[model samples]
Target: MRTCPHPFASLVLLITLSAAAQPPTSPLGPVSPTTGLVLRDDAVRALIQESSGDRIHDGVQRLALIARDTQSGYTEAAAWTKTAAEAAGLQDVRLEPMKDGPQWRATRGELWVAGAHRYRVTSYADLPMSLAAGSGAFEGADVELVDVGTGTQEAEYAGKDLKGKVALTRGPPVAALRNAVVKRGAVGVVSSYSTPPWNLSHRMDGDFPDQVGWGLVPRSLSTPGVPAPFLFMISDRQGRELLAQLRAGPVKVDVSIATQTDTGHLSIVSGVIPGTRAGEELVLTAHLDHYKPGADDNASGSATLLELVRTYTTLIRRGVLPPPVRTLRVLWLPEFEGTREWFSLHGEEPVRRVAQFNFDMLGASLTRAHSRFQVSYTPDWNGSFVNAVSESTLAFMNRFNSVVYPPRKDFRIGSVTGSQDPMDAHMERYGRGSDHQLFNDHGIPGVAFSTWPDDGYHTSGDRPENVDPTQLHRAAFAGLASITVAAWAEGAGALELARLVALHGVRRVAEDEFRARRDLTSVPVAELPETYRLTRAAVRIAYQREREALRSCLSLGAPAAPVQAMAKALESAEAQALGRLEVDGKARGASLREASPSAAERQARTFVPRRVKGQELASFDELARKAAPEQQPRVAAVQAAITAAETALRERGEGELRFYQLPDALASYADGKRSVADIRDAAYAEYGHVFPVDALVELFGLLEQGGVMTRIR
Candidate 1:
């Protein structure tokens, strides 16, 4: 009789064996598998159609129409694409506009320009906090002017509220003072100088969604550490002379600006690249439109995907790319608004999508990028195919153009934190500021791509001239490797079952009894239905946390040390999640009453053991005969994870570092050292959400103290 390898057990063995073979590495979580499970053409094709973006050929024609006189947005872009659609044998072509920013505000005060109305809010007092205050530091005292340089210190602001008069403070050298000014609320501050001021410098947090780092500060970019704000570098000595003039007399001006919300026509563009296979699906996508003129901003990717339509189709026609395993659906969304609408329209469709490959800003120099071949993956994909199912889809980027363009080199990708133990992750999400968000929110595997270290992001200079072809090639090739292959090493049932299990883990598709039972031929245990599948994954993850906490409590052995504090923190967290504090005297409570002892006692206790301590474990069929009908499979799964964790805790070194900090892309984006554009490119590189670089670093610090992981350095 055939028997299946234990799913949870196999996962344990994989982790155990891999760690034994590796050496010390970075703290950036474990690197993951770069390839995806290969599927048959029919299955893959269905998934593709359910995914991918629109296929437009003859870029020159599409561009020609876009460059036409009447083009304001995607509406005209789509209307002109009729001929291209017909040539591609597709009928519908849409040009949809995505509305973003009005909902997004610049957290920092903006520097707007109009012919004669040019004013610069040089200090933090110019932001919203000060916006409501109306007057700039209008204190009622005799104004004594002090050129304290940039007031970036508690000390600079020490002992005085320099109000009612110009408090000549220096621009910040190290710490940013935008927030400090809100508290200081000085009369008026004299900013000695500034570089070519960024109109969007003070951006609303929401506008920059991905966690791209601003970048590592070039040593020569400015003076070493911004000492006192007075010493910080600014534009010119002329501005300094002007500041000296301000101290000569009283300067007062009325400050007034009106802000209102307006209604405008909003749209989202969507197109498709069909596949021969009808059932399974794969999605290829990229945002064709942006808030600013983004040729390299996205023109590089725009041109790239337009070219991919030709490349993939040509491969199919020549039988080189092979028939897709699923139907491919290509989408050129207008970003945020388009995603919201698409989901609203088709949220209920139960299409089996193999994966979603999202390509965003994919043009930049490969050699200069922060995370070479780095791709940010969402934490869910292939419902049952994956164990942790933490990845939306497998996201991989070529190390350099060389990784994809052959002379074919091995794409050496690094975790945002690569200096750790066994490399099991790409740590891309640390840099997840991009377009893959909709899919992740919708519960699909989303992998995004962009060249890390986005030097030309959002500024006027991020033009077509700065675009790089190799970056596009790396992203496209990496995406194809993970989503488009075939051959069922685990068999069709495993493929299907794995997908089912993964989905079941996430609460997407429900598990059907018939299918689970049909595959029972290889089962060493009884078949499970949806109810059992869910209970297991949640409880397993839950107990893993609980067990670690309990062990921390035990290790401290005594009650109030750091170890004990950690144990208590975990215990408190576990109790909140489960609805009851499992403290000594309070095991049973109203919130988490179901899993209590009384609850367990109420349900009949059935013990149909799968494995014995001495002999080979009994099969599910045999256990069923001896077992009572009351035992729940979920209860069994929880007990299983707990038992496993306890075993590991005994042998211990440090726990999995992945649990602590974010991936390398994120780390690069985080402010301690790496650059911002690098982090932004990570999500674009991997096709995922973009997080703020500075905030994530703080989070990494918190995780280190929690004992889930230790910083590698």
Candidate 2:
């Protein structure tokens, strides 16, 4: 028997008992100061208690049985989700069909190695990820297996004959196909690209094989010169065995794949909980597509969303929770491609979306999955008060649980799952892997609630058993609380959000100041002026970004009074933060100049950067084609940097390189109204500390040369 550590636990228990004994009421009480909405700790506690991890497990178990795509499996999963939403008592539950490009469906696939030692490699019937999505049908044929280590690089295949043979690699399936099959004429590929916390082999007890999530052989590569090859994913242990056989002597593999491809509709399951305001909406979304047994990758997210719908509907129907002022919309998409199709079909309707919350891989057990929940926000340019609200809600939950449960390592008395520790979560910056990227691309402020470092992510090992019910409840609670606050926030709530933005602004400025000061040491005394100019530009842009965030609150119908109050608060905070910089400057024996526009600003004011008419978004190829002979080398360098960074991002499965790319940032900020200098300043504010000025200049120069941007005087 465990004893409560604090008197607060007894108080909390008394409160819980008292609340449980009382009857449900409309508009649940205890309004939060941060969100200007009723938090209803009692209701939240009840919902959490009622939440079934077993239900989540069951849902994941069902979804994980098939690979959800445009095939029959996808249709089945969509129907099931729609039914689940309907069963949850959600209104207007329906499957929205999206017309998309070619849909690849694996009907059958098999691989067997028959050289040095005979062994079966994989079977699609057993593990869908083994076949690597998009593989075309092929008759069983024996071919020599040649080892191409990390087959993504050309150097890796130098002096090796890959013709009429199978390329074996430790690289990703996609990369191996591109390098070995498309370029070198390999008939097939065997890859073993493991998930992150790469030290899993050292940490975990056995030889664990990882799933190759999905692989694609582009149509463009299937021309007369390059034949699309069948790609098979094998475990690291199996791949090692093949490599050992190859080192000892020649190894041969027999491969066969039978797949179906056709123009099909990607299913999107969606429904709405109507609010008083007709058009305003808060979207709760999660992708429902992945390899078979992709429990953590997306089944968890889908289950969590369903549970949220159930909880919200139950509470609203029972009159224990008030319907939001703005409608709450739920979407289960087939990952990125499906999201893109949905947006294309809806077109401008996204403009009415106030906020979007995406759930992906959210049910990982802290102990079993080796994961932690992360509340990731939009970029600084797209920042809103939502970040503050969500972070604060999560912080409050952590504090509340700490007091109520006390400290215990094994488990909590009332906790439904194994772990006894309080919910551990932290705020994360912008990331670009899931469906949220599409929303953010369309100017809708979106956040992703997910867990990271799961060894079984995108692998066969990600089963229903790895998901913790308590974590599911916690995730559902955090997501619900944030959405509810955003949906119901009135003028006062909007004002609170503004205050948070101001606070965020203060922190951003302080961080920039600290970074700028630290950077000063790395530069020569003669270069201080340039560095100072850049730092000042960053500070001004930071304030402008905050101002933009506060202004966006108006879109949510926040009253003028609150907006004005926010402005005043932001002004005070900015002044105080800048004041400290001056003191620090004096102490460092350097006279810091007041934040002001630089010579670049003056030059930029003379010209506006406008988008070219009827031109597509700039790509590396377009930039190269548009560059002059002399500028081609510099253009190539920029392209190389971006490609290398993206490749590193894919291989590591960690870091913010995906979000920090300068080309995308420049493209996003380069509107006709903003000058070149303004765009540069905004980029500096967002990512200037990490990227050098020369690199930025070159990227902007390429964009200008590529006609993606034209300077009009």
Which candidate wins on TM-score? Answer: 2
Error of 2 at 455 (Å): 1.9
Q: All predictions: root-mean-square deviation over Cα?
A: 22.3, 7.3
**Deviating ranges (above 4 Å) for candidate 2:** 1-40, 50-52, 115-117, 153-159, 195-214, 224-227, 402-404, 407-415, 491-524, 547-558, 590-634, 640-654, 657-662, 688-713
RMSD of 1: 22.3
Look at candidate 1 and tell me the lDDT of residue 243: 57
Provide the global lDDT of candidate 2 against the true structure: 0.69
lDDT (tens digit, per residue) of candidate 2 on 1-713: 99757998889999999987675453323345433334555655555555566667678778888777436888888899999999997889888888756778877789988755567788988777788666767775568889999887778889999877888888766777778877778888887766533334323422465434345566655665433578787777788878897888888777777886788777889898888778788888999887777887798899888888887788776656667778888899888767777777675563388888999998788777778888876776676767766776667666555544555322221245435545668777676667776677666889889887676776667887787766776777788777766777656555555655566556655776676556554555555655655666666555666777777777766677767776667667666655654454455565445345556456555556665643323444556665678997788777766556545544545454244434664566655677666666565566543343344456666777776767665
After TM-score superposition, the amount by which residue 251's alpha carbon in candidate 1 deviates from its true location, in angstroms, is: 11
